[model samples]
Target: MSYKQILYNTPPTDAINPSLTTTDGTFRLSTIPKPSNVPADKLLVRVHYLSLDPAMRQWLTAKRSYIAPVELGAIMRGQSIAQIITVGSELSSKFKSGDWVVAYSGWTEYALLSAKEVEPFSVPAGGRPTDAMSVLGMTGLTAYFGMTEVGKTKVGDTVVVSGAAGATGSVAGQIARIQGAKRVIGLAGSKDKCEFLVKELGFDAAVNYKDADWKKQLKEATPEYIDVFFDNTGGEILDACLARANRDARFVICGAISQYNTSKPKGPASFMTVISQRVTMKGFIVFDYAKQYASAVQELGSWLAQGKLKRKEHIVPGGIEGAPQALVDLYKGVNTGKMMVEVAPVSEALPSKSKL
Candidate 1:
């Protein structure tokens, strides 16, 4: 059996699918027909790679969020790299078949989107289109603004990043170092991931959050206490960082993957530490920095050239068929870096596997 697309379904709590891919209770492959023709205002492209981010989990909920939730039976929403297969007559002058671009292509083998919905992407010097999905893409931009604009990392600041081995958190930690933070420590799930952070990624040290002595490990890692906390996991880690926060430290809340699956998400028990420590805690969405993206990209691209920034992408198998389980595996910490699915051939070179 084959499918032209995949559809979003009721989540685990409200629904479930027995298929192994949909075991997490979200999506299922569908046999929808491909569009016979492209509209004059839109273009059709075959998806090459689709980014699998933790944020996609939040998009499944019915609750009010930064963006509207996906409606059941609709295409699952996502971003992807694609080669234009056809362009509308109106856009033919500017875009053509075979032109590679990025767009909100959803979880399908092909996407037909408006000219405004798809944009061209030029691989920067020493960078590949795959980087667009990892470092040079949303993951990188999220880290850029979260560190510079929100965290305001300084030369003397001792920075701590939870979920430090994941895409956004990994890049966020490096960006903190690039911005001159005195010490950069990471919080990861396992000893191997912790070693990856400290040895491969240049983190000053790392704490395995799953370890029995992790809290003591955290204290030992940040003796001067944390001046900036870049959080991707928000439960106990957030509470721990709150208690260890230096006065007026900045906490950049990029995500809360730890709480995404829980019915009653735990609020920080160290809530009073925010008051006592006079900490500045803020949650941010990447789109909030749209106006400043160009500058961020320029600087990030330069770092790519200078070797100051590196990236890790975990490309799962089975093409588009692999996406649902790949997403499910994200919360399982199966991927040590950015997670993606290659539905078709990508135009850029990617490392055989993530170094971290």
Candidate 2:
């Protein structure tokens, strides 16, 4: 049978305009043959949702990094929620057909993935398996590890989160509160996001960075020094947080979305603060804590079950064809929470119910 796929045919040059430039090319829908001979360790899956992450922009570059860049003519890489439709004979009993799973399925309707490359997940009561792609998935794990390990968040400490309304930042700020933070401050782009952070997500205070007096607001919100700063958008916000950091404060740099698209990256102007306060700023990749992912998932899942932690997803409807635009929207900060693309209707494999 034939299926639709989005191949990364274009590369971003000056700025990513998927419609006009190949620097980040537009989605190309194509028909491809199904795998006839299934390998013993491989499985066939039908993708339901595709994660739209800021990291995808970096993946398009040919520069050397921790992970290999996505090559031209290849499927755009993304984590997806899928269902195992066919399993190899050797793995039939281990993983049967119709099993929900999470995998690096890329931008396609159907995927032939290695069993080892995918992880099986159970749908929680009153929740769908798509939660595995959001709060209880890589995004959650990134927050859990970054806050606990790198940030070293402690009780009674004042915590601050940049990109506070976004996926990982929202979770990080909430987790800090649960861990006994004295105050949790969130910095977001718009008034609505700031309101969501303070009113809906239970943040102590929020600052709208787009406002002219945002710096004054940040100082007022964080009267005392910030103990932990979970930075997702590293730019002036990072510098501001650094200036107000307490002695030996911890800075967990998970992402620098503000600088991802820029040609000449700018460092924080308050570089002196790093030495003056003797702060501990560290950058991390989620894969570093892979061994303890299960423990973190169990804890985060429990929070979701008890309604202690909340999650929101900004789902863009359209299959592989919409993948390109969804990515652009993510960079533009149009998505409120976790940005995702609906590759197919989840109603077929699993219904979208109360999500994590």
Candidate 3:
């Protein structure tokens, strides 16, 4: 039997903007032999869904970052949901062949993963197992920590979220509302996305950053100015949020996707406002709060069950063959919410084991 995998064949041209490109040889897909013998304390997993995130592009860069970059000719790094096909005798007491887990399994159809390297997860109420990759997953955890720990959102504070239609930003805005923000405004890229943010996601208002009058709309949406800014799209939107920041505002720098694709990286030009407004600006990674993930997931899960939180996802199908296109589409902002690719379909019709 053969299993497919995607490899890192070409590093990006620049370090800062390591966006995925279709230029020949950027990524290569190949078939490899299936594992014939699984080792003890290890499980053979069939990959199901592979998360497509903006940060995946950044991981290609060899720059000094929170984490190391993927090496040349190595498997592309990604978080995925996989089903156990077979488990080692040492691990059989704790796990079964049908059990599901989320792991940093990279871009492969089947992998031999140790139990310690993956986490067993169950679907939260109002969330699917796939949510372990999206709203109820690391993205949700990022929003939770970015809002409560870093952004310090408070009741009646006016909040603003950039890239609000994306996975992290969308949940960040709603969590702001759940935190009792008086007004929650979002910055999205399209009119439909703005509408989705305001109508479906329950944001107080949403501004289309692509609109010519975006600044005006942002101003109109937050008349009292922003007390907390959860910034994802950094360049221009970061500057705009700074200009509208109220006194004693907090800026949680979760990501800077806007500048990711550019040749020259840019910073917010409105630093002066940070001084004038007595702002508290900081950047944080969710890994820093790893210890509290379980508790945070509990609270986020409750909100999701109570309808205080919402998420959207764009999943590209076609098995491993669709992985490259999914990354390309994600960078183009072609996905409205959490973007991912289906490596193998989750099947429920199997006799005892399903969800490959």
Candidate 4:
């Protein structure tokens, strides 16, 4: 049995520029032997979509972080929506073949997943199963928990979100409004994204950081103090928000994409604002609230069903080969919404497990 896979060759010192490592290669797309056997507690799955995330960049670096770096020659680590092709004998009663599941299936076309590692999910009515990988999946869940639990946003409070056009930020800004924020403002890199955030996603206001007068525009948009700041791009934007933070503000640091690739990371220059404003700032990882995933999913799904929540996906077509460029594009801010790689289409008929 053989399947295609993208292997992480080594850590990227700067960024994922394929040309810089073409000789030795930072990531290699190759076809290799598939799993011949699955343990009784494992299921064989065919990956249909691979999630493209900023965190993938950090995972490629050989640094100490919440998770281990991808090992050389190992399949690139990625969250994926897959279908169970062959159910292990012991797991037949729980999950049968053709059941859709989500897992950290990496960049392989097929995978052997531990029963504990995969969760069976039903595709939403009139929605693609890939939706479960984006807005209805971890991205949405991250926004839910980060905004509500971490930010502790209150009614009549002004909320500001960075990376407003992205998967988590777009949902975070909307959730804040749903949670009773008086005003919701977003900061994006481009004018089109700013328009999408305000017009399409229902953000009260959006600021394009690319403009020379963006700081002035942000200050004008947020006339009242910022009660909750959803910090996604933490370098300059976080500092700017801190300067305008209201007394006793809440700052939820979901990600720091601006500093992810920096060789020399530095803290915000306006650090004293936290003390002066008595702001509560906390950083969190989505996995911390794994037990509450169901509740988050239910709310997000309901929002999606009622059209209260809108989602967009920039899907790059190609199987495993497209993953590398897709990852680089994510960091370059080429995607307007949730970015993903379409590995294959969802269908009932798929290859069965191959026995050794």
lDDT of each: 0.84, 0.86, 0.85, 0.86
Candidate 1 stretches greater than 4 Å from native: 1-3, 14-24, 347-356
- Candidate 3 residue-wise lDDT, 1-356, digit = tens: 99998888887664322223454556787789998999998999888899887887788888899999999889989999887888899999988877778888899988999988688886644567688888878999999999999999999999999989999999999999988999999998888999999899999999988899999999998899999999988999999999999999999999998776656888989999989999999999999999999999989888888877877888888887678777766766777889888877666412333222
Q: In model 4, which runs have C-alpha deviations exceeding 4 angstroms?
A: 19-21, 35-39, 347-356
lDDT of 2 by residue, 122-218 (tens): 8787566778988999888998999999998999999999988888999999899889999999999999999999889999999999999999998
TM-score of 2: 0.95
- Rank by lDDT, highest first: 2, 4, 3, 1
Model 4 scores a TM of 0.94
Compared with the true structure, the alpha-carbon lDDT of candidate 4 equals 0.86
Which regions of candidate 3 are displaced past 4 Å? 14-24, 348-356
Report RMSD for candidate 3: 2.5
lDDT of 1 by residue, 1-356 (tens): 23467788667662224253544557777776678888998898878888999888788888889999988889889998777888898999988776767778898888889887777777665666678777888999999999989998989899999999999989998998988989999999989999889888899999999999999999999999999999999999999989899999999999998888777789889899899889999999999999998888888888878888878888886688778778778887888888888887653323222221
Total clashing residue pairs per candidate?
Answer: 0, 4, 0, 0
TM-score of each: 0.93, 0.95, 0.94, 0.94
| Stronger candidate by lDDT (2 vs 3) | 2
